[model samples]
Target: MRFDIPLPDDTARLEALAHLDGLVKPVGSLGRVEELAAWLAAAHGSMPPRPLDDVRVVVFAGDHGVSDPAGPHGAVSAYPREVTASMVRVFLAGTSGVTVLARQVGARVRVLDIAVDGELADVPAEVTAHKIRRGSGSIDVTDALAPGEAERALAAGMAVADAEIDAGADLLIPGDMGIGNSTVAATLVAAVLGLPAEDVVGTGTGVNEAGRARKVAAVRAALARTADRASDPLSTFTALGSACAAATAGFVLRAAERRTPVLLDGVFSCAAALVCAELAPEAPRWWLAGHRSTEPSQAFALKALGLTPLLDLGLRLGEGSGAVQAVPLLRSAQAVISEMGLLADLA
Candidate 1:
């Protein structure tokens, strides 16, 4: 509740726009580039908007018990449950797409083992155990977490944000690495937006026809269990969302509280962004949609958040890879804002 959210400052926005008008070009030649510069100014509540030079991508890795459990459990992912931990190790080893992308963006990567099912053995120093639990309860059958699990997960995320900000990370990207998380995000989107599960569910991780059908059913069940209270952030998160979702929500909330901008990645972080929106209402002031995930619910999440993503290359990989891909654009937005000369100066 202490998101202590900042309001978008029109004065800062106007100041940025004024500067943009002075630049050496047609008044609006840069188009959305000018709009983005103003938004950065508004988000920071500063006229010149501090540069996003220290972008950090923090990925919350967890495992879900709802994953492709054997037999009657059905498949929520095309890959096995082992895939979550496998990808976490991949992230830790610096070979994952997100790791490679983060390097390309000149951003530091922090992979946290929040709640992977099996313990991550000998994780790198950059990877730490912020484990809220080994794995979340299956949402299709029952509440995915206990009454207080959402708060704990959220607190863990806030702590992560504080540490990163204290250490001088100016921009943050919150990513998720749980295999079955898209299902939960779909359920969250449906429940929060008051839509049918079918409207928000998507075939995550390239599931087959049968697997996609099973995923839809899981989302419906999870939404049914949530009932009302979708507007209640903690209750909604505990009932139908995963720990990684709650943690990502917390991370976003903390970033907004500190007025540090966030690049939210994919559907998983969208669900978390929804949680922050429900709780703080003004949190989106400090956030931007990094990409539109291939997940169907991601579109709904983006619409609900009123965010137009920076890219949409049909990215479905969710290790913060898509979000990191947009950092260069943020840098570009800053560059065009700060470096372009006035027409008089150009002459």
Candidate 2:
């Protein structure tokens, strides 16, 4: 689908900045929150950007077939593809951390079964199923997805974003739900940032010390497997990423095209942002780094994106729960920009 939203007007943004400077508080005292409002206005081509009343979170779940190897981490044999659907079921049941946090922030949560292999019979009505393939091909031996499949996954995500926008969703938070996703995330980060696997690999889902070592080794193997392939961003994604990664990248691009703000979660989300930046550089301006995850690779990805997260609660959850926690702060920033009294008015 083609999205053709116009860029924000420069003159209108300048005027909004001036008005912000004249607010009651000290200039720039509101920090990133004030900047966020100004950014919204700039994105909308208005003096004061309007708060998005319809906030929806899309959590794309997939399965990675590359977690079968037994290495220094003693082989994550229990991390099966079925775990992807199991956790997604938990998310749909509103029992996962992401569901709880989203509810607290007044944001609707929607789970997408992008490429899970098993049947999700008990999935809630709100959860969407867009299974592109049973599961991604094993990156340890070959590419994770076919080139055409990667593009289809991306388009699927864009279609979801379009539908959400059509339904009046002003803000979009595209998240991920998959076991062994960190391996893909690390590879994507390493590929896009031109870094080695060791630099971007980290233990995910509470892996022990040995498990962390094995995860890093798996990333190296995947990188080596795809070494002869082109270093193009899409190529890297199709080689090492899951459907969740491609979908998230598409969601980010669509959000930028519509001038909507996107709150990024942890490493998985950041990996998607890296792909989005490679595809559409301007999209990062529309993103807000919600928080820094406990994962080391998340920090590397955030730094690569030049985004300082609003919170540093040492969160490592991937269900977009970390991002949801920052909604209150964003709301407070909007309040400061639009509701705070002027000095003259107080006098």
Candidate 3:
């Protein structure tokens, strides 16, 4: 299915190149800033790429079936599944890293309760509820989600993108928060790349050696169930992606369709981006990787997408913190390309 994602506008992008070349820097001295400026110009489809006037961070919250501490992988979580619900409250209270960085950047924070395993009592009126299922089925035993549930999550994500655009958001960042999420991400990556889980899986949420071993085992067993379907992105997602990742994939595609630029976050974000790329080949054109995470699977995903991140501070924190931290650099790049004095004029 060819999704409706728009191709980057080459004409405007060429114009942006000319505009950046006209700046006082000795042609590309600004490095990735120039690269980002060109991409913004294409994505915005306008000259000067307009300052990043408004940015929106959407945190997709869910819980993993592997997170049942009483369940088989329960031995794998640094925290319980209930923490997913509690963290939603923390995000709502604006005390998390994403909230603080977004507030500093003058951006808005919107949390979506797509499939949290527990209740978020008295959630703010704005929190979008697009829960496709209470929690995913265990991929090691069965498909994480039914195909119909995956489709519903995708449509809900598209709707969220439309709502943000209507509300005047020019830049969108999708974040993921879920317990035992790394297992899901690792499963998707391993299956898609036909890689052994040991190469792709890592210590998530600060798991110990034994926990990492359990995660690897779970991912390997899941891929055995995934066998043929593993190579197809959407099928892999249906087979093992967390609800949050699947929704983020849809949101990424929809944002690209709207021509909004996105700075993608770490491992889980890259996993979603892989699905986005698979669903629509042109989707990655409208986004940039904000950082390369410590997770080996994230690197594998980034390699597949052909995106190079702007920073590498050894960051592994999710919730869009790494992506948001790169926003100022985006602003600086825009300013340098749009406001710096021309070299000819200086001469």
Candidate 4:
């Protein structure tokens, strides 16, 4: 439960900045790209960090009962809750947005079903080995998880990170797949940041105006329910966060613990990261905002985390697409820092 992880090496970052400045280019022509390289160097504690040869994307999939059309809250998503399971099949078939992008960058993709509502046929057992329940409870009226489920989901995420790192993943991207997840994520953000529902709720999954209003109302109710637990991270998560999001929080914490650079996708990732940062204040140093998601909560969460996004493409998709889109740019930054000739060498 206690992260207490070390921050990246500042000495290595300073040295990398010096090396970038000494490169055959203007003092700050590369802009944030230069900063990105320095960050990787610091994360690795080396002047020239290792190549991002093995990038891995882990998508945590689940269902939110609040999204159930039959539920009293009604569906706040454009898609039905059944789509969560269908999307998992698409991910397993390697045809999802995250999978396609990861393939383009030669990165591996693994979709874990942390709390999908129903059974998934033809899926590898490893994907569901950490399944905590059928689905998380509706946060608007009930706790997202029963007691002790949050801890199990967190441990599942940590184990997944360890396995990926042990398998030679140099870079990691945590994605999300679930209908109405944005509602769940926005609720978590509002609770942890003391923000009102209007500030955190958005048009998640292409919801209409009425749907957005419902979302805001739902978040407001959840906030009131968990207002007292906001100071305690675990209690807050248990009350307002989905199982997949709790797992995502654990994944972020463990990646920082291992000093592996992480590219955060969108609202889901950032909201979970907010909880992780509360758990370990130093964890955000090892993370980079992959892009500026259109999700209002994402922007607020990134601002809270003090991260600058590499791209601002108005992305609202949550399946790590934004992070994957920024991979080439990160690699270019890595190349400039690790391969560009020093000005003195040119002389």
Whose TM-score is greatest here?
4
* Highest-scoring model, lDDT: 4
Candidate 1, residues 106-172, lDDT tens digits: the string is 8998889887887677776556557888888888877778888899999999999999999998899
Model 1: residues >4 Å from true position, as ranges?
Answer: 71-73, 124-128, 228-231
Candidate 3 — which residues are off by over 4 angstroms? Answer: 228-231
lDDT of each residue in 1-347, candidate 4, tens digit only: 67768879999999999999999988989998999889889999988977899999999999998887777667789998888999999999999988988889998999999999967967899889889988899888899999988888888898999999999999999999999899988987887788899988899888898999888888888788766653677777788998899899999889999989999999999999998888889899989999998889988899999998999998898899999989998899889998898889884
- lDDT tens per residue, model 2, 169-238: 8778877888778888888888777778778877687777777777777788888877777776667778
C-alpha TM-score for every candidate: 0.95, 0.92, 0.96, 0.98
Worst 10 residues of 4 by lDDT: 226-235
Alpha-carbon lDDT, every model: 0.84, 0.79, 0.83, 0.89
Residue 156, candidate 4: how far off, in angstroms?
Answer: 0.5
* TM-score, cand. 3 vs. native: 0.96
Candidates 2 and 4, the one with greater lDDT: 4
